[model samples]
Target: MSPFWITAFLDFSADGFDDGLRFWSALTTYDVSPRRGKVGEFATLVPRDGDAFLRVQRLRDGEDRIHLDLHVSDPRSAADRAVGLGATEVADFADDGYVVMRSPGGFELCFVDHPAGVRPAPTAWPGGHSSLADQVCIDIPASSYDSERAFWRDLTGWEQRESSVSPEFSSLVRPEGQPVRLLLQRLGEQSGTVRAHLDWATTDRPAETDRHVAVGATVQEVREHWTVLTDPLGRRYCITDRDPETGVPPKPPTD
Candidate 1:
C-alpha cells in the first residue's frame, strides 16, 4: 500500500518567442501562462502518477531541446492529436513507433505509443495529472522497507510487488525494470550541490512549486536550464523538456 509516483517532462522554453509559443500551444492548446514580469510561461497536460510538467525558456542563447518519450493507451490516435496541435514530427522507431517530435518552442517530446498491453498507471501526487494516456511510474529512494513502504502507502496510493527484487530493493506498484519503482536501501551522505535534479512538469508552475515546498522538497537555486529541486528525502532531480545533452531520459539499450 505504498503511494504511487508519476513522472513527466517540462519543456524548458529557452528558444525564441515563436518557438516557445509553439511548444506551449501544442501541449495546453496555445494558452501560455503569463509571468509576473517575465516574458511568459505555460504547461502541458499532466500525466497520472507524475507530480508536474515544467516549462523553461532562456532569454538569450537558448539551449538544445531535451528529448523525451511517454507511453499512452493509443499510439495512432495520440500521434494524430499531437500533430493537429502542432507537434513537429522528427522521426519514428519500430517498437512503439515513437513519433519523434519537437514542440513549437524547440523542446522535444514524443507522443509515443506501441502495440503492447495496456500500460500501468503512475504514482499520483497532490498536483499530479488527471490523464489516463499520459500516466507512467517513477522510482524513489527509500531508506528502510518499513519506512519506505509506509511512506508510499500513505502518500502515493500504489500497491507493492509480490516478487522479491533484492534484499535492499523493493518493487512498489510496477514490476522490476518497469517504468516505476522505489529503491529502498541505505546509501552514503551528501557532498555538495547535486549534479542533477528533478525538473517539475506541473499544471501551475509557481503554485505547484509551492506545494512541493510544503511536501518537504527544498527549493534550490534555478539554473540556466531549469529549476533545481530536491525531494522530501533530499534526492535531487530536474523538471525540464529540453536537456542540453540527453535531457533526463535513459540511453536506449543496444542489442
Candidate 2:
C-alpha cells in the first residue's frame, strides 16, 4: 500500500479560510488553484515550476492542522491496509475518490488516486535564499511514539532515518519524485493525540523568517536551528536552517 506521491494540506476553519489561503500562497510562492469541492472547500497551491503538491482545505469546524494525502493506485485497499495497522476509518467517499482515516495516534490522513507528478523546485526569493515546504513533522506523544513511527514507515514503505543530532527525531526517506517527506518527533508528554505541522527547508533561516514576518507570520519561538511562526490564521509551522535543495540540516561546528 505504498503511495506513489504525497501531498501536504494546510487545513483551516471556515472563519479563516480566505486568510489562510492567502497567507500560504504568499509564503510558499504558489498560486491558489480554483476551488473544487462541492462547497468550494478544497484548493491546491499551484507552483509555477512543477506539479502541485501543497494544498489547502476549508474545514466546516475544527482547529487548523496539517494532514497528508497519499496518492495511491488503490484507495480502498490502502484504507484496508491502514485499518489493519491500527488506523480507524473516519469517512469513506469512494465515489468521490478518497478515503479518510485516523492513525493509531489520531493523526488524520487521506488516501486518493491523484496523478503522479514531478517534484517542484525550491522557490528562489528576493533575499537570495531558496525555500521549500518539503516536509511535514508529525508530533507524537511519548507513549505512542514507537507505534506511530512504525506505522508511517510501514505504510509508506520508506526507510526510516534517525536524526544524528537529535534523539527525539526521525524521518522517512523520501523516494524520488515525491514532493513531501515525513518526519516523526517524540513529544515530551506521556500521552496525547498526534499532531502535524509544516516545515520549510530554507538556505537562510533568518532571511526566510524575516520574509515570512513581513508577509504576516508572527514569530512564535526562535529555536537554535528552527524558527516557529504562526500564520495569519494562527496556524503554526517552522522554518528550518536546512539546505533547500536537499532538506539536510547544517552540521554543528566541530570542536
Candidate 3:
C-alpha cells in the first residue's frame, strides 16, 4: 500500500537535536527517520496502520512560514504537552476539538482531534476520538527563511524538518516528528499572501474572538469569527473560532 501523508513538516535551522527527540516523545511513540527520496522523514505516536512520515532537515538562508493542523484525541491535553515541550499558546483558542499552536520555530500548527488522531481508520477511533480524523495541510508564505523560522520556533518550540524537494520547488517543514506537520515553501509566483484560513471547533465566536485578538490575531470581521485579520507580522489569515453548538457560520448575509 502507498504511504499517504497525514501531515507535512515545517523547515527551520538545521540544529537543536534535542528538540527532535522531545518532539517525537510528545507526539508519537516511535522513531522518525529520513525517507528514501520521498521528501523528508516521517513517524506516528501510536502504531501506524497506514503510511505516514515526518521529514527533518536544516534550513538555508532564504525561507519563510508554513502552517498546518494536527488532529489529536484530546485537544486540551495535547495542547498542554505542546506548551511543556516549549511551545507557547498564542492565545488562539477554538471551542471545537482544536487549538492553534506554534513551534519554537516560526511555523504554525494546530492540535486537532481527528477521527483516530492522525490516522482515520475506523478501528483507530477508540476513546473519545470521533472517527478517523485528519488534518488538511495549509501552507502560509514567509518573508525570509531566518526571520520566519525564528518566529515559528519561538511560538511552537518545535525545530525545523529537513527538505528534499528538488530545485524546481523550494520547501521547508518541521523536523520529522509525529502527530502533525508545519511546512513552508518558496515559489516564484505560486506563493500568495493568504492561501487559506484555519477553522477550529468552538462553541462561542465573540468570546473566542476576544481571546484570539488578545493573543496576536487582529479581528478582521466578526459576523461569526469569519473575519479577515492579520497576525502580529501583518500576515492575513481568517479563522472562525466558533463551535457547532453555539456558533455555526451564519449563512452569508444574502447579498
Which digits, one per residue and each the tens of the lDDT, describe model 2 over residues 1-255?
A: 789999998889889999989888888878889999889999999998878899999999998988899999889899999999899999998677899999999999999998967899998987788999999999999999999999999999999999975899999998878889888999999998999999999998898999999999999999987999988777889998888777878887898
Candidate that beats the other on lDDT, 1 or 2, i.e. the better one:
2
lDDT of 3 by residue, 1-255 (tens): 101123434333334333543443332333554333333322233335644433333344333233454555566776777676556677545575668776544345667654432332222112322111122223434434444444444434555554432232222233332333333434344333433222332344455445446565676665523455655444344444322322223344576
**Candidate 1 lDDT by residue in tens digits, 1-255:** 111222244334354444544533443332444442244443343333323333333434433233345455544555555565545567765354556655433335455542223223433335553111131222223323344345434333446554242354343444322333332332233222111123333333455455556645577866533455654334455443221121122334599
Q: What is candidate 1's local distance difference test score?
A: 0.39
Alpha carbon lDDT at 162, candidate 1? 41
Model 3 alpha-carbon drift over 4 Å, by segment: 1-5, 8-63, 67-197, 223-225, 241-255
Flag regions of model 1 displaced more than 4 Å.
Answer: 1-66, 94-96, 114-197, 200-255
Runs in model 2 deviating more than 4 A are 253-255
User: Could you give the candidate ranking by lDDT, starting with the highest?
Assistant: 2, 3, 1
User: How much is the lDDT of residue 46 in candidate 1?
Assistant: 34
Per-prediction TM-score to the true structure, in the order listed: 0.27, 0.96, 0.30
